[model samples]
Target: MATAEKDGKIYCRFSRPKSLASMKVEEEDDPSGPTEITIDLSSGKVIFIAVGKTYNGGNDLAEHVEAPVLSSGKVDFSQFKVARGTTMTLLTQLHGVAMVLAWMLFVSFATVEGRYFREGFGSKMVCGLKLWFQMHRVVTMIAGILTAAGFILIFVKVKGLSKNAQAHTYIGIIVMAATCGQIFLGLIRPDATAGWRPKFNWAHRLLGKATHILAAADLILAFRLPMVSPEMRHFGTTVVAVWISVQVVWEVTFEVNKYLQSKSPKVDSIPGKEETKIEEKVIWKDPNGRLQLILCILFVLTIVSCSVATLCAILIF
Candidate 1:
């Protein structure tokens, strides 16, 4: 097949075989009406039939034309198979996977582990740096790098940004920008004693959460991108579901712990004052809280369900 343009209209010509005496070409300009072409090849001369339509030299060609049926003898057209080695498709898939995994690692491992350190549940110091802060910083840095790389890859693959880009593309840009802003805010985060500390902290938390949610949505949208296979779509959906489940479990656990800790009585005393009397705080001990137990069971069930469903989909589909 060859395509050419003349007189502001596009034309595509398919080479005919010698054994094919006559053939009919049909083009669907609309769902209800199709344009047809009849070629008489009985004169033993090579004839080229041009379909008067504007071809954008993309996958739209496949949508416009129907499969050709030879009137005479069978002709093998396997040689015209579309090549699948294009850089755009490969780079898009790479960008999608890399960005998805990077964000997943940030949410599932880095953020959760950092919280553990922050809450004094783990060792505070690691190799001279504060464990929580360092883990958060490193993971965020890696995630930012991956996001930037994927963002650039998309632009490179598309040659430049298009005004008519998909919603996912726009959302990705916003997510990357928000991530960069979040990183900057984190670097200049004030100490607990600072007046602006609470405000900054809330802003940082909210922005980070929003960015993660948007990133998850962007990953789901990637399944709808051109050239993505059904199996890959299912895989992407599974990853999104797993990430969401982990996030819900972590958030619920954190909230429950916070609520329990708030119920404990606090100590009131000055550390270095001579006239001050220190009053000890009452600690609440509940190793097996009902809410915690229920959340854990739910979390476990979610993980199991996601795993089984994903495996079944892979096998069945």
Candidate 2:
């Protein structure tokens, strides 16, 4: 065993011998023996020196040794400066890309698909399911898969949860858990004609909306993290702002169109002829159906544009 004393503070090392046979312990610290060298003074402030092979296969699990402190009572970390202009790790890039695609692209696409494309694709069927249902389900599933993968990659890169418990970390975990829950809820959704279908639909919509909001917030937070470049943060924040504006416009347009449809006559006729009222619920085939389809296409196009821009910013900046 070797011990270091600096500025009247003592630091010690404890270790098991490499040999299987036991040896007699010495009363005094050995200066010539191996020791555990302390590399970081920022956290846990302890310093050590290697003595021999550790008890647990080479792992060092020794208790903290009293650290040497300056007269000001501060442990100086001036020697451990972070490297400037260091490139981000590959895992971090992959994690960011995956999350951007999941929330900025797939989630938004899925929401628009379910909200406005149902009537446009109401007549089309994919297998036994409606086209809108298939598209929404598939897109949402992809988002969930991407979210899970991104979460795992970041967790592995970080080697576990953050010790400081950052807000970004907490929000990310919440978004991931909620995304999984949303997928499960979708799978167990009641049939359209079931008695509880209304409740299910409302629950699903609300959960989806909440998850989407949180996911967006998390992405913004990620852009603002200390590791991210300032250029990326500015570009990402701008892209998100424009994307949100587009969403608001699309939603307002849809609501206005729906309101106008409700107030207008059910059927169109010659200008001089009496308009007829239909009793059947509106799905498609209305006079404004083509307009709704056009609106959906425009909304989707705008969303895709914003997502692509944000992705490019993430990759380049």
Candidate with best lDDT: 2
The per-model lDDT (C-alpha) reads 0.60, 0.71
Estimate, for each residue in 130-160, the C-alpha lDDT of model 2 and write its tens digit.
Answer: 8889888889889999999999999998899
Report the C-alpha displacement of residue 312, candidate 1, in angstroms. Answer: 14
Candidate 1 TM-score versus the reference = 0.59
Which portions of model 1 show Cα errors greater than 4 Å? 1-88, 120-123, 126-128, 261-263, 266-317
lDDT of 2 at 312: 82
Q: Per-candidate TM vs. native?
A: 0.59, 0.65
**By TM-score, who's the top model here?**
2
Clashes by residue pair, model 1: none
Cα RMSD for candidates in order: 11.8, 13.8
**At residue 48, what lDDT does model 1 achieve?**
22
